[model samples]
Target: MIPAASALARAGHEVLVACVPQLVEEFTSAGLKAVAALPDQAECWAEITDTGHDQVIKVVVGQRLLARGYPELRKVAAWFEPDLVLRDGMEFCGCLVAEQLGIPHVAAPSGAVNTLAPAAIAPLLNERRAEFGLDVQDDPLAIYRYGRIDSLPPRYSFAARGIPRAVAYRQPEASDRCEPLPSWITELDPGKPLVYGAIGVALPTAAASRDGGKASTIPADPVRALAALVGALSELDCTAVVSTGGVSFPRAGVPPHVRLVEHIAQPLLLQTVQLFVTHGGYNSVREAVRAGVPMVVAPLFGDQLDNARKVAELGLGEQATAPSEIAAACRKVLGSSENLARARHAQRELLALPPVDEVARRLALLASAR
Candidate 1:
């Protein structure tokens, strides 16, 4: 969203981000004007680890939080009263406010929208709408009335009925955050394949042990999962770079063949790596596709499973459910000419989409139309 907001700002839009107070600094640091729309108690939703029935609970929790913050958000909307509202898919407060103000609202792609049915969220959204003195919305996708800006290639996108109006746009590489290639990356053996592994930002933290290890509140076991992936990668004859997603693990347990870090510039690293091992988040999938890198997707939850399915269906990569299967999946994708070809094809398709500037211009036009 920072990138999208920055693009709009650069296009000359007077954008003011309405967010939690905690994130005001992040927005201001990115050169965006921001206001705290909600009180400090309205905490953000935690990461979703369970993609089953528990996902509905998570969605309800998010709606309830947005509902609680709606009064403050209404104040922000009335004060800002300029034009259309552009919100990430999960945020319903903006939609509610826009509806109240009789302005258009656009849904920006944050993840696979089709993962959760609109009907699943209608009851909660309507409840919030009633409280706001607005008409109850029967359509769950009402927030996307102005349309959406999609970054995924056609094959990677989900098939859903009643999807809102949308335009395709390419995601720019993270050049701003990228640093020069590190010494370790530069010094890697050219003769050996360079594989990169990341479980993503939402990975559960390490479990506590008798030896005084820290524990996580998240229910998922990402520590064990990450270790499995690293172990499998180490067994192969490849140089592996594994990001632990800020979760600390026993450094002594990491294999000599692997380099573990809390984080790295993935978009930049993808440029040089032969294969990417990812948790199949939409951002990671899009980046790998744009970089023309084949993948081994080990999806943990949510839209990740959908992304993994698409990767396999499109021949862009393979999927592995267990850590022990990651190496073979990587080898299979790397060795397959078809997989590489498909990845390149997807890359070309993504690159052909309109750039961010054009997307920002179109969004501005939407505001003007309203």
Candidate 2:
């Protein structure tokens, strides 16, 4: 969605993104106007349940926040009155407001909203929309559901509850989302496997893990962990693309074979890469799946650990607490011809889904309808 926002702005729309303050700069840096949609509060919690109950709880709380902030949002909207509104999937208030204003709106999922997850939470979402005097039938958006792509399920449970699923947003290889990396990453022999290691943007310290009664950064030793994984992977013939994610890697003893960058074109990087080593953020994991590549999940905080567990349970990827064992695991995944075949096969299956551009086209039509 970040990439798409830039694309929309480039297309000459006056885009005013309503989002958390921490992320406003991302849009502005990309040349779009931004508005802070929510307060900058730090909250983090562990995931003990996967029945979507937590999402329900979040929606309930978000409603209170929306009620409190509606006046401010209205003022901003009144001032901006954008030609279109795009809301991040978890943030429903913007969607509500867009509906009331009859603005062409697009919902972009910042994380995965699987069939299971969405089904469990649709009732609450529909009810919340109703309370805001908005149509629950607003277009559905399924961005970054899995693999670094966006997709909507052909249907959502909201339809069963009388909220017809609107047009969904999806794209397998949205060029606007990722910047291309150097060609050196392509040096790997296609016969030999490749791994892409990444840690996504860290969230503000979650509410539950505040330290000294204040918010603290994530505790994972990401750099050290990546180094360990690289060492383990050295024994294998595969090359590794290690993204530092705005962190600088120590240069003293770095390996030449390892390609290090702050970020890579996610969709493009996923294509040839055989395995993804990630912090298990929803977007990263889902993108990998959407691309059909397998993964090695090293969940650091919040829902990441649970996402990693699900990856392992679903026979889609492996998991480890430390990087020392990553190589052996990678080899295990490679050696199992069926697993390798399955992972690649999944990629092909997902690729068969409609690309994101088609989804965007549908959204434009729906917006016209409104």
Candidate 3:
């Protein structure tokens, strides 16, 4: 999303990123005008599991966040008077705001957000629409009325039917400086393959206990999962790098074959990595695809399962859960030319699409017409 915002700003568009307080600094650091207009949603997502069955579909963002966020968004929109609204795929408030203002808006692709069933989410959003004094929309695709942007080709998309699809455009490498890789990473076992494994920051690593901040809020025990992956990677013949999202790792036994660090330049590292062991976050999957790297996907929850299934379906890699299964998958994937070929094919497709700068140009044309 930072890449998208940055692209628009570079194109001479006046962009204001309205996000929660925690993310304000990061957005401003990117050289964009950012404000803390949205509410803190940690507690909202945590309490969602107890809600009704219909409400469970869009767990992360729903009426609760919408109620708190829409007012803020409307206030900002009234003054900013944006010609077009670009929103995260999971965010519903922008859709409602666009509808109220009778303007255009587009969604950026998200792993699980695009996969949400419109039939399931329509009633939920329409309820809010009616309350806002807007006519209730019957069209399931109203949320994406102007369409959505995607890095993937149309045929390779994970979004369900009726989600207005955007033309395929290359998603940039985010262009942000990632935490530096330890200097010794390139020095290890040059003749053998290099494997990179990372579970996203949303979940807690085994080392999260040492960080002492927000680790308790994570509902699942990702530490055991991380430990299993570390254990498996330790025995593999290849050199391995695992990122623990800035938390201290392995209280004692540190193996030479593997390196556990707080962070690394993921976009750059993916280019050299022979195989990626991932928790199947979409951004990670997208980066691997852009790099033409094969994957061993072990999805923990949510849309990760869907993304993993898409990986397997595309012949890009294998999916596994258990540590032994992951180890087996890694060995098989590393040895397979087919997986590598498919991955490269996806990369070529991504490369063929217009770059994000060009996409920004098209978006500007659309906004001007609006």
Candidate 4:
């Protein structure tokens, strides 16, 4: 949403993001205006990180967040009187408010559309809608009443069987933001292939470890998974840069060939990396495709599995579940001329799609329409 909001602001639209107080700084840092719509709640949506929850618990949490957030968001809408509301796919408040105000609302998918299927959440959404004296929707995808702006090409989208309308826009390749690389990065052996590995920021951090209390320990599953990747990469002749996403690791245990950091500028790192080992988030996959870099995907949760499937199905890379298998998967993709060719082909496809500016122009037109 940051990229979309930035594009819209650049296109001369006055934009204000209504979000939880926890994210206000994030929006402001991106040079966008943001209001704390859910000020009372320090973090209202933390349940999203509980990946272990069953479908019923996930639905309950989604409904609970929606219910708690809508009243606050309605207050925001009344004050702001936005001509149109643009929301990430999971955020239903925008749709509800837009419906009440008779204004347009656009659904923007932050990840694969499979992650936002209306069928999965429509029953809960309609239950909430009825409490507000709104008519129930028969069509599960009515939340996307105005339209949707998709960042992926058609072949890469996991949109359901029926959607109202959609426009494809290629996300730009990750740009060099002029952030300085770590000093240690410069000292790496220049002769070996450079492989980049990251599990992304969506992983839960141990708060106890983040404080001075104790060293942060990642959940057992992720720790083992990450250990496997790091262990597998150590066997290769390549120099690997692995970002633990703040998961603490003993420095002595790390192989000399691998550099571990809490965070690294992924776009900047991808620029020169030969192969990517990723958890297959849509943005990560898109960026790797943009860079013409093949991947070895180890999906952990959510739509990551689907994204990983697409990576292999599209011939862009391979997928491995077990830590023991990741090395061979990486080796297979890295050595395959076919995978390299396919990745380059995907890059060309991405380059051919309309830019975000075009998407912004279309959104502006939608806002202005009667």
Candidate 5:
């Protein structure tokens, strides 16, 4: 997402990124000034690891840190005086700072937030709003102070809550949109049955362990499960495009037909592929739906399970708890007329909507207008 911001900066905008300290170097490399914030990555990690009898302990620590750092955040915002303060939703300080500075701010959600009348955090949100000298409102929907900027369809949240669909944003063919795949995979025979497999971005490399133990050839046991899914695809004579993701495949033992690469550009692959097997991350599901590719999701943790539920409920995809079931699910989707028909219909609906860039532009426009 910072990369997207960098692209915008390249288009002749003055952009100052407010992020934790560790990300400063990477942001600097991309030619943006960085504003380091309180509760840096290490502290956040400590909070994550701070588990014991009292679950509220972490929250207590977080509140203390945030309270201490609010002044620093205000100082930074005053220094930058940005035309628009685009923020990740999780950063409450940014919102407060933006409000205090009387600057137009936009909520660039990293993932889905509670779209309802603030039921998920009504008490907390209300209290925070009061602290910021905002009015209390009965309508939960009115709580969204800054307009939302998201890649997801508005239907994604509205339909989940039984509301009528609002027209969503669309992206035009901007040169800055995700480019075509590198020439190598672009030439693959699009006619063949392509099965694209992926885990997500956050997982550790299978080779690197925290304990510094012998780095196994396969970094994590999850690969074994992923490999099992591949074997199942081979059983059905499907061409498997397995993304090993920085983990080397055993040279002598790889299947003859499966092509193993570290990564295949996802948006491009989705265009030509018949099936997508993925970890059900929000980005993967959104991309697959945007491309209209039916998915077989293997959820690991967090909102992935919820995402998988949405896929299955919408008839856009199927889910597998164990890796062994992936192949059978693939075959089911491939062989069943009902599954194929449902998937195609879902794809058609998704593709007709606008692209993500247009969505961001609309959000920025709406936020600035407010």
Candidate 6:
């Protein structure tokens, strides 16, 4: 979330960022204040069919993005008279425009709202909050009643299996603004073991956001899944790299210890890698648990199969899909030292949270105590 919207615009607050037109210049080049309130990304991922992720996120992605993004986010929250609306976890019209104007709505981090199931999407968002006349919620976490926002911490959470509990923060190892790592990544091999890979950029930017036309319900062909993620990181002996966010593949049988690139800077190359190879996207498993690395997951769908089953149920790695199980789950998480100490104990529980500029001054005194 652009490092908590650049720490709530460096604590002065007033951050906008509604989003959709394939990310309005990634939130106006990360200076914040953005719009395109919704639509385009092949019409907001054509309600991601092939159904059944809590019945396609409660009967089709909260009624197709609340009937195409609730009238420009309720005319941009009734002309920005906002205190809090902060939606992100598959944004359902910023909690019905903060309950049609009562305010305070949180929920930023998302692996589809941390593996769905708030009584299976709260009786379909309480039937769209009683057709937006509000006053409905029987609390399957009344759209999180101001308690959501996480960057993984609950013993390496992917969140749902019973939810409500997120105020964790601190996952910003990189991308408060990206693009830097490619000076031929200092010519690879510091004697092998580097790996990286990336089958993301969310289904080829939602199947090439119809800037071309037709073909969208993203049935995955992301250039043949980036040619089976550069043919399983060219048979991994290490020294990889990958990215391919700019998708294109098949360099005949890619070798020379792989390289690929369509973009890199992945949490600054997972802090000098040693095995990642993801698809288990929940912001790439909270950027490989803020770079303690260790994955090999090959999930290719929403909540990336519950973040590859919480990275092999918290051993921090291993889950594969074909390409010889992604080169044997990248040589079983590069010959596990107990999955590299459970990925450095989920990077010390993502460095014991808090710091996102102290959760943006405790969410601006929780929207100025409403």
Count of backbone clashes, every candidate in sequence: 0, 18, 0, 0, 6, 0
RMSD (Cα, Å) for all candidates, in order, is 3.4, 6.6, 2.7, 3.4, 5.6, 17.6
**TM-score against native, each model:** 0.89, 0.65, 0.91, 0.88, 0.73, 0.33
Q: What ordering of candidates by TM-score runs from best to worst? A: 3, 1, 4, 5, 2, 6
Instruction: State model 3's lDDT.
Output: 0.80
Model 1 error, position 217 (Å)? 4.4
Candidate 1's C-alpha runs over 4 A off are: 39-49, 53-63, 112-114, 158-162, 204-217
Q: Comparing 3 and 5 by TM-score, which wins?
A: 3
Top candidate (TM-score): 3
Query: Which pairs clash in the backbone of model 4?
Result: none
Per-residue lDDT tens digits of candidate 3, residues 196-276? 999876675423633555422454456666787788787789999998776445646758778887778889888889999
Model 6, 1-370: lDDT tens per residue?
Answer: 8788789898787888888776889778868888888765444456556534764575334666587777788887788888987777777778878887887888888766677777887787778778767788777877788878787787787888777778887856665557777777887769989888888777777666544576467756777777777787777677887777875566676888887877767888888888888888787778887878888888777777777877898888888856568887888779889988889888987888778888888788999998
- Candidate 3 at 42: error in angstroms? 0.7
Candidate 4: stretches off by over 4 Å:
39-61, 158-165, 182-191, 204-222
Q: What is the lDDT of residue 34 in candidate 2?
A: 79
lDDT of 6 at 194: 89
Cα lDDT tens digits for candidate 1, 269-364? 998988999988888888898899999999877678777877898888999976678888988887899988988998998888888888888888
After the best TM-score superposition of candidate 4, give how far the Cα of residue 159 lies from its true spot, in angstroms. 3.5
| Model 6 quality (TM-score) | 0.33
**Model 3 CA deviation exceeding 4 Å by range:** 50-61, 175-181, 205-216
Query: Which structure among the candidates has the greatest lDDT?
Result: 3
Give the Cα-based TM-score of candidate 5 against the true structure.
Answer: 0.73
> What's model 6's overall lDDT?
0.77
Candidate 5: which stretches are off by over 4 Å?
Answer: 1-14, 25-33, 38-71, 102-104, 112-117, 123-143, 156-167, 171-192, 205-228, 231-234, 248-253, 336-370
RMSD of 3: 2.7
> Candidate 1 versus the native: TM-score?
0.89
**After best superposition, candidate 1 residue 160: deviation in angstroms?**
5.0
Q: Write the per-residue lDDT of candidate 2 for residues 287-320, one digit (tens) a residue.
A: 7766777877776655576677776766677877
C-alpha positional error of residue 10 in candidate 1 after TM-score superposition, expressed in Å? 2.2
